[model samples]
Target: MEIEIATIGGFEEVGRQMTAVRAGEDVVVFDMGLNLSQVLIHDNVETEQMHSLDLIDMGAIPDDRVMSDLEGDVQAIVPTHGHLDHIGAISKLAHRYNAPVVATPYTIELVKQQVKGENKFSVDNDLVKMDAGGTMSIGPQCELEFVNVSHSVIDAINPVLHTPEGSVVYGLDKRIDHNPVIGDPIDMERFREIGREDNGVLCYIEDCTNAGHKGRTPSESVARTHLKDTLQSIEDYDGGIVATTFSSHIARVKSLVEFAEEIGRKPVLLGRSMEKYSGTAERLDFVEFPGDLGMYGHRKSVDRTFKRIMKEGKEKFLPVVTGHQGEPRAMLTRMARGETPFELDDGDKVIFSARVIPEPTNEGQRYQAERLLKMQGARIYDEIHVSGHLREEGHYQMLDALQPQHVIPGHQDLQGFAPYVDLAESQGYAVGRDLHVTRNGNMITLVE
Candidate 1:
């Protein structure tokens, strides 16, 4: 059998992730993602209301034009997680392929919510639910399994596609976390078993997002410690405390809520995305949200909640809002710009529980948000978080454990790919032979 894989997106850049694997006539596509930087850059333009093709042309969604020929051959559209960059484009693009979208339960529900919320586009494709550690048949000769992996977002998985040729592991944006707070730890034994199979893993399409950095990615528990230390230091402050982070980070949000409760403050989750993700976690029993915790889903409701908090006593409540990356429309950014009902006092703290993604648009928006908050005399505490992607040491651990026949460094540009190649080479994997480095729209074919 001859197996071929195409890097539709996320091979040369950080966003707009989609990859296609072809075993015989069956094709499976993974991660129809959005380029948030591009989306934010083009926000408010007429193109915002355009179709998927237009959005792809504008660089907001994946370039599925590369898979136009195999649209009918697609077996499933699988998303590895719930991150917008992983599942955001499904509403716009999944309808093109007449295949069921198979994903974790949280991801499926989140996609449903996104589709219902996106008035401009609708997906007619079937939505199938799968959980971590579940297996399903995508084709007569292709079996897919979701191996649980730890990441910033909940329900992230490392998908392994077993074909007649061999098993291919899609291991993007994952880190080995032994001490996760919300989910189970990384399944190293499963990966090791796959590596020891006779056919084993033919190609390991791995995440290299942070491969340029050294050392293992810190566990989420470390982040919890950091957050506790920072928030506890300000427990005695009479002013208000406002925090912002990725809404999909349920573990971090849980930690924030617990800390707020411990400090004798009511935790209020504000913003639509915040409600969407945290509410999902609640329904799925992943996290037991405090019953008294106030959550506002709409703009009007958020404004009302903020006003009530202001009227009651801002110091008595901890407000967690969206816009850690400082999207102009997000609640935190609106608060920073004085567009919201809340005020930032001279000593009020704004805790950023996320690291800046370092994309050009993110850097600009974060910089502007911080500047405005500074103008309002708000104290800022940023980078009080850990990355979801693996660092060099974690990558080394994964490579040694998986022991695939070939390795493909993904989710990085030429500069980002350099250190990834160095690490893989250090593992005795040769370039252009056992280890391959390619860009988007390129194909890597293996015959068995």
Candidate 2:
């Protein structure tokens, strides 16, 4: 059986991650994602109403036209997680392929929500729910397995395709988190077992987002502790305190909610995304929030909640909102601009429990948001968080564990792939031999 891999999208950048593995006549695609920064760069771009070709033209979503060249039946469209970068394109593009979208429960629920919000395309693809450590047959010659992994979001997994030639590991975005806050740790034992199997790992396609960073990526528990310490220090501040983070980060939100209660503040979930993600997590039994906790998504409801917070004393409530990256329309940005009912008084505290994404667009927008908040006498607490991507030392450990015959650096651009390339070379993987540094819409034949 022949094996071929397609570097569809996200090979050149950190977002819009899509990759396909063809094991003989059966093909499985991983992560039909979106480059959110591309869409955000444009003013008032409503992707929900946009067409797939238009999104592709704008480079916001994967240009999957290259899929025609790969001759195989798509057995599954598997999204590794629920992050927009991993599953945002599903509603737009999955209708084109006659395959089910398989993912963990949380990711499947998020995908369902994303599909319902679509206006241009009617994505009726079956949403299959599979848990971590589950296995399913693909075609007749292959099996698909999900290895539980730890990341910024809950219920993330690295999908593996087992074939006659060997095992193809679709290792996109994850960190080596042994002590997580919400989910199980990264399954290194499973990875080592796969590495020592009879066929071993044929190829390892990795996320190189933080490959340039020197040490290992810290655990989500570290960020949880950091957030607790920050909130506790301001326990006695009689002014308002607002917090923001990735809406998909259920673990972080849980921590914020717990610590807010500990510090004598009622934590309220504000913003559309904050309500959508957290409410979904709570509804799905992935998280358990206090019965009195409030989640307000609509503008009117959020404004009403803010008014109540004002009436009840701002010092008694902690509002966790969206816009950690300073999105123009997110709740935090609205608060910073004074467009919302909540007013920032002198010495008011605003905590960003997330890092600014390294894109120029996000950095500029975040800087502007911070400036506006500071102008209103808001004190900013930034970067009380740890990254979700593996760093240099983690890459060395992965290579040692998997020992794949082919290594492809992904989730980064040419400049970002440089550090990982040098690191792979040190491990005796040569360029064009075993280690491949590629771009979008390219194909590499591993066996024929």
Local distance difference test, per candidate? 0.88, 0.95
lDDT of 2: 0.95
lDDT of 2 by residue, 1-448 (tens): 9999999999988898999999989999999999999999999999999999999999999999999999998999999999999999999999999999999999999999999999999899999999999999999989999999998889999999999888999997899999999989999999999998979999999999998999999999999999999998999999999999999999999999999999999999999999999999999999999998999999999999999998999999999999999899999999999999899998999999999999999999999999999999999999999998999999999999999999999999999999999999999999999999999999999998
Off by over 4 Å in 1: 45-48, 69-72
Alpha carbon lDDT of residue 161, candidate 1?
93
The local lDDT score (0 to 100) that residue 196 gets in candidate 1 is: 78
Instruction: Pull out the clashing pairs in model 2.
Output: none
Residue-level lDDT for 383 in candidate 2: 93
Residue 2 in model 1: lDDT: 67
The number of the candidate with the highest TM-score is 2
User: Which candidate tops lDDT?
Assistant: 2
